[model samples]
Target: MIAHGSLILVLLFTSPLMEAFSQPTKVVTLVMFKWEIKEEARLLERRMLYLHETLDVR
Candidate 1:
């Protein structure tokens, strides 16, 4: 019975630590995704500008 109680306590303590460790990975992934989106937008804007210049030249 004592071992079981201690095991439960250990699990409770570690669960929060595990969640804390996982949070940073999630944050990094979200940050990376945002950066990718921003880069894509920049590329699209550049392409549009190039197209506009070509049309203007013609």
Candidate 2:
């Protein structure tokens, strides 16, 4: 009974170590893309021009 209990304790402690060694390493990559805001700026300028034209067209 003592041997059986010792074996069980040994197996339980070793299982987690075996699992860590058996798994492959994982690589994680974070990618970010920067987009130019020129188009948005042009759109805002056009809106401002339209507002100016409406106010000045009278």
TM-score of each: 0.75, 0.35
The 0-to-1 C-alpha lDDT of every candidate, in the order given, reads: 0.96, 0.69
User: Candidate 2 lDDT, tens digit per residue, 6-57?
Assistant: 9999999899878766653321111111123666678899999999998995
Question: Model 1, stretches more than 4 Å misplaced?
Answer: 1-7
Model 1 steric clash total: 0
- Alpha-carbon RMSD to native, per candidate: 2.5, 10.8
Q: Give the TM-score (vs. native) of candidate 2.
A: 0.35
How many clashes in each candidate? 0, 0
Q: Residue 36 deviation, candidate 2, in Å?
A: 4.4
